[model samples]
Target: MPRSLKNPKKAKRKNKGGAKKGEASSSSSNGIPSIPAKVWQPGVDALEEGEELQCDPSAYNSLHAFHIGWPCLSFDIVRDSLGFVRTEFPHTTYCVTGTQANSAAANSIGIFKISNISGKRRELVPTKTSNADTDMDSESSDSDDDEEAVNDGPKAPVFQVRKVFHQGCVNRIRAMTQRPHICATWGDTGHVQIWDFSSHLNALAESETNISKDATTVSNQTPLVKFTGHKDEGYAIDWSPLVPGRLVSGDCMNAIHLWEPASDSTWNVDNKPFVGHTKSVEDLQWSPTEQSVFASSSVDKTIAIWDTRLGKSPATSIKAHDADVNVISWNRLASPMFASGSDDGTFSVRDLRMLKEGDAVVAHFTYHKRAITSIEWSPHEASTLAVSSDDHQLTIWDLSLERDEEEEAEFKAKTQEEVHAPTDLPPQLLFVHQGQKDLKELHWHTQIPGMLISTAADGFNILMPSNIESNLPANTAAA
Candidate 1:
């Protein structure tokens, strides 16, 4: 049975301030902080002496309660004040090349807002006044009369679809952080389509009703802007978080295209794509700190860091995995730190500041039993991350803590004694989420702390820590 992380065991203590052989020292001669060894185990919660605990197989179900069947290949959560998520699913059974022989149908994008129970139950009750012989008797009477006529009934929670657009088999969907109403999607057609719902938003404001419940499916409407440049199908697309209207996309043919909005309401595509990978470019991520800097992972088993203003050659490249690199995520809070998951069922973290030519990986985890499909760094917690794999599992990790030097030595000594033990566990494994089938992608909510949303072949799930308060809104901090 998998171990439960609701309560963990405390690890024994060890000494500090010493470096072992082949280990990087705390302070290097070059005045740079040497990258520490990544063998630390998961932190255990302290328990009383001689206390025993029982395990429950159903405990994992509490981590998430909401699940809906929506077969989607890729989805993105809007970073607006209101929590809205957009998911895109292939319209056909299989997504094929857009050639005339295999004319696969378009996909459907569904926009949804998670329901907020607390906001619905909240009633604005007017306070009672004690003034009977006030100077402004008419004003006081009007206020009292208004209060008497007010209704205090609780409203129903809002769970409705905002909109749905039927486009091509979108391999990737990304909502603009700066403009949450505007989103972009691209797929096998080698074309990127930009969709803007600013008019629909205005209609909702004027009507004061959610047309989302009636779910509008737009098929005939054309995209606000469309740009085509890739030779083959596009797989990865990301709008720059720092730069407005700037976009980057990667395709199956080892090509990465840059798109910028021109004054004529059309987008200007770069004459040349960022070409270096020998295989298909699987994923792309822009650095949270640097506007011009981005990273791309490929089937060639490497991840390349690129500067938009520089030449086509990568600024730095590293052999990231044994198999194809499926996903790459830049740490939102830490500069120069990024994580990659691969088809080898392993994930590694790399620090650009401490990177050397031969060894760029600072830490490695090999817990997932199958190939990792997606990886995301938490926006709320810098050291927290989430990974999804082909083995029908989603795991959360916390890498903020480090063990002391003496503790490290003791762990090594014990490992030498029990060489046959299962040593594949990651030190920072915090929570393991199961029960989903064919999991593809997972993401942390940008506005809500500790809330996560995942998409799979069977359905989509809205999950959180079991201890999260039920009354919290989709965008509010849980108690």
Candidate 2:
């Protein structure tokens, strides 16, 4: 752990679920074990001890939830945010990764079916005004728009864990199109497994504690592909953004490997224990827009850009941050623009073209009070970026030198004319939790601009940004 972080659990509880009074409950429906409800209604009365509440078992039309896992890290690198992907169909299900606190062994993973869910739950944020950060229409326009609101009904008990896989929790999860499955790599264990939604029922049955051997069917078994290449606990995996049958993985070894699954259903390694850093390789990203480009980060405090087509040292290596880099992301629409987060508790936007060995940071943001845990650049928008951290907050930043109206009109106009005028500016986070859990990994739905999704350590999450204002909700007042 970086000496910068004293208590890994010293969570700041920024966007939601912090205070009481006037704060409306249920911001973006994220972090629930099951898929969230289409509608969520707050209770008329305050929650009492031992009380349970029922959450929508189906995808949250408007909201979701997650659990507080180990202090070592979170459950999922991808958290339930808004608009990653959501459908009204009841058959659509999401998965959550689990992590055992302080385990040297890789944390196991778990599966949760939204269907089996229907129990007591609580609004992470009990206050109404405090949750008012992003949803301008949620408070006043939903009723007029004729969207059915959550009934101001009685509450139920909070959710509990039901399933465990691989004996630990997932550190990161990525969807591979070729395998057409979700691939999860645990925190302590150096193993990665690929699972499919088709295995939903089998995983559910296998996960249940009371379920007997009487269960039958092909869907109940989770067909797995475990890669034994990484010697240390694996940190991240990205399915080849270009090729379908190939995948890339990184680990504490400070190197990346390409795994080719041949026709025989067996896997072959094309790269050896290549080395890049002296510390753990925390994250890696293969650029979808570029076939030969990839970016990686590590606790060793360096960022490397590799052309897998080449064999020697990285084509470009930048001393990125003072602490461990947790995640790396690239702007698909913008060439040479990428982002990275670190334990030093900051994130940087670097222009690969302008980046130099020691001069790594192009623009930096330091709002997070804890280590920046995860980061993602907009797939469509160039200037918008979203980040999550150990501090339990998600922030979007816009880096356009253009958005700065205060810039000397002469300078701004000059830069605009001298430089290629982009249809957009820098990066910006459009909607925060609107009052919800800390962000984990965030994915934008294939084509939806405002819709995004995230998964927390606790459970499942799917989010849709509401037509709302941009501001942290009012502070939660004590009851």
Which candidate has the highest lDDT of all?
1
Segments in model 2 whose C-alpha atoms lie over 4 Å from true places:
1-61, 66-96, 99-108, 111-164, 182-184, 195-197, 201-224, 356-360, 401-439, 456-461, 467-479
Model 2, position 23: C-alpha lDDT score = 19
lDDT of 1 by residue, 357-411 (tens): 5656777998887888889988767778899988777888888655455765675
lDDT of candidate 2 over 1-479, digit per residue (tens):
32111122423222232112221233324433432212112222344443333322111224433332332233322222223332322212334444444443433344433322111222322222222222211121111213222343212112223333444435555655544335545444577655544354354434523221113221233535676667777766777667765667887777677776674245576647546677787888888777766777878888877886787357777788888888888787786788888887778888776664457467887656677766877654577677766554455555653444444345546434332123232324333342444345666544334334454433234444332112222332121
The global C-alpha lDDT for each of the candidates, from Candidate 1 onward, is 0.58, 0.49
Q: Ten consecutive residues with minimal summed lDDT in candidate 1? A: 90-99
Worst 10 residues of 2 by lDDT: 136-145
RMSD of each: 17.6, 13.0
Kindly provide the TM-score of model 1 when superposed on the true structure, using C-alpha atoms.
0.67
Runs with alpha carbons beyond 4 Å of true place in candidate 1: 1-70, 82-106, 117-157, 201-216, 263-265, 402-425, 467-479
